[model samples]
Target: MCSEGKTTPKIVRGEGGYVLEDVPHLIDYLPDLPTYPNPLQDNPAYSVVNQYFVDVNDNVAQKIVVHKSSPRGMLFRRAGPHQRVCFESDEVHACIVTCGGLCPGLNTAIGEIVCGLYGMYVVRKVLGIEGGYRGFYSSNTTNLTQKSVNDIHKRGGTILCTSRGGHDTLKIVDSIEDRGINQVYIIGGDGTQKGASVIFEEIQRRGLKVAVAGIPKMIDNDIVVIDQSSGFDTAVEEAQRAINAAHVEAESIENGIGVVKLMGRYSGFIAMYATLASRDVDCCLIPGSPFRLEGKGELLEFIEKRLKENGHMVIVVAEGAGQDPTVESMRSVDHQDASGNKLLLDVGLWLSQKITDHFTRNKKMHINLKYIDPTYMIRAIPRNASDNIYCTLLAHSAIHGAMAGYTGFTVGPVNGRHAYIPFHRITGVQNVVVTDRMWARLLSSTNQPSFLSSKDVEDAKKGATDAAVGRGE
Candidate 1:
């Protein structure tokens, strides 16, 4: 065998078939072999053959060098220890921003981040990106000093304004780069998180050094991994309170029927949790309740029949309940509030009318209909103690991860606790679909009537038949 330095080994035929001589050991042959360079290392092309040697012309060669493309003059070098120290100094600037609809604990999150970065990490200059992604691009920003964020911890809403149209990926990255922002903290739900991921990719593509972090903020509690979202507990508490009050009212009126409608576009966590908490809810109708259009009509007839037999009824309905086809369609035809969310009052009213009409025509019995909508009320109450503590812990974990150089992650509270996990690990966070297991668990934990029961099934089917004939009216 003939070996050449920095070249592939060659075999030569001799008088004795083939002669094996000057054969470099396998370990010594690696340095001369072609290999790719590390993209992150400085002068990576030149810093090749770290620990191995090569054989050249039947002799052992100590050093074998391979040349490749390199950065030309004026290109920024990989950060050195001193350079990194200066670049990540206390003077380095950053900002936090919120976007879209108002979620619970937004102020708490912002306050914690501002305090932790400035007071604990010595990151002094932090700006708040107002109006979300649109603000980032339109130069809508506000300086967040320690004093400005002090009283914000107790506040329920976002101190920095938010908007849905704020996040344009390219424009946001350009703004970040232009501002020399070293770090950015984005607070929102899935939409904001996706936007953050896009911005990170664009910045890395441009070879710019910046870090982005995300905090989950949606009252719907649709995000995975985190068992609970910032505003969910508060919303649930409010829902339960309203439900309990309605139950009392129904009991007080002596034979009066009360219907309370809640907000949960697709997932029934809010309705499920509230129903579980209020053991007196006679019938709970949520999206994941195994009720089809036929089943829904059956349910209304069952209520009318029950009211005729027992003089009183209480029903809880999720906003996503009934076969509405689509949430947008439901919202469009629905009587919405100022924020464009479907008004639970309208839903409750429609269902109540149906129940009243069914009983009046079928039994010639007049029934009183009381519709109660607890949508906004659920978002109005102060956060529960458990929720406040959980939100604070989640905030702390998020900031800790960020200071430790973690990225592409989300912090949340799960199963009455707090935990941090990578964003991609969440499976799917955008859609508003409910997991069957969760729905089943919520139903099992509640005292509500099960659709699978023989009596419920029979009553529901009879009601469906009556509604189909238009005789239930």
Candidate 2:
């Protein structure tokens, strides 16, 4: 183990900005665990590669841009194949489970994991836990094979079939121990990953020789510490069709307003990117930044101004935008889903009705408004080319980390470099639009006002900082 890879694993440098926290390893508890040659060494695929294995000391810097006086900043363990592994191929039995909502690359992620374990290490007996975490004890599992998941990447949704909030840590671990499963691959969002972290602690406390690996999945792009979520690009790309359609609908009529709601519960990456990509958006709203509905220089005023200027305008709002209960009694009923995520009101419907009522009752003018909600459609499709390649890399990285005895961690890219991120660093928090260059660029592209005030900017900045600090970014 490296010097900084202590039990606490904390390293600080340069005015407390730089941090290095190593991921948990099997050696931390079971110090006598022996090492074996990595199975990739014998495979012909990586046989000729000279600089293949990643060093134990190799770390990816979290911050790319820092002052000259600043230290190297936070660093993460660089992810890839290791020259040595803690587990032999024949002794490994892996199980995969996909939890939370559906994302575009779920099938691709599942397929890649099965294929990577089966083809690279020749580890057979991979099982898929169907119906989310409950399937572990529900006896609703399926055997996974390379041939069984060969073409699953071309399909949409997860082949394992997913649900949310069935995380019974004790029962799940009991099932794992009974089945003799050693490696556990869990794919899901923040809540699901939080569950994974708890499971890891339980397994570690019981002194089980189990490796718990996580693959972060969220189309919302909210989970912090990673560059972006798995299906973010696909969601943003698929949103264009709705944006274009809204633009056409708005432009086709007099006093036209097209409202397209996208999927962004807490973060607004999808809505912002979709609005930026589709130049037809006159206004964009997200949950990170607050806005007023009816007032001087408010959202209604902006809509009216845009309509007067262009004769037709488009507004793009994330599903989670304007969720404040004080915002026109929009959220009268506050309910949560099985995963504990708040069930959001249809902002598109509420916003469209507000615009219609404001025009008809207040202004005594007729307006044509069209609402397009493509939230589920965007996430339910197959992964695009970008996500396909990314999911493959993520799957491979997770396999390598688990084989190298790195447990209780999730795998993702930090500042364009893939690294193993500890589960505690990423779960229960989120990454949101920081109202920095990206938000400014989106506002400039849409020609929209700040909508709220300097408070939103400050709050967004503070949220970004808090997330960075929480994730050790």
Minimum summed lDDT over a 10-residue window in model 1 is located at 75-84
Residue 30 miss distance in model 2 (angstroms): 1.0
The candidate maximizing lDDT is: 2
Local accuracy by lDDT, each model: 0.59, 0.87
**Candidate 2 lDDT over residue span 426-456, tens digit each:** 7655634555788889888988888757877
In candidate 2, the residue pairs with backbone N, CA or C atoms under 3 Å apart (3 or more residues apart, or in different chains) clash, namely none
lDDT of 1 by residue, 1-473 (tens): 10111222222334422222221121232223222222113434324635321112222111123235421111001111110121233545878988767766788888888876665456788899887777877878889888998877676668797866424577777898889886778888765666666665566567665556678877777665455678888888778777877777776764678788887665666777777777767777775445432255467556656666667777888776664533333455556543233544345556666677666776666666678887766654446666666656666556544443444556664433333444443424322233335445555654344544466456546644553233101
Report RMSD (Å) for each prediction in the order shown. Answer: 17.7, 3.7
> Which runs in model 2 stand beyond 4 Å of their true positions?
1-19, 325-331
Clashing pairs in 1: 5-56, 133-166, 133-167, 134-166, 227-414
In model 1, state the lDDT of residue 58: 24
**TM-scores of all predicted structures:** 0.68, 0.94
Candidate 1 residues lying further than 4 Å off, grouped into runs, are 1-89, 292-297, 308-310, 325-349, 413-420, 427-449, 452-473
What is the RMSD of candidate 1? 17.7
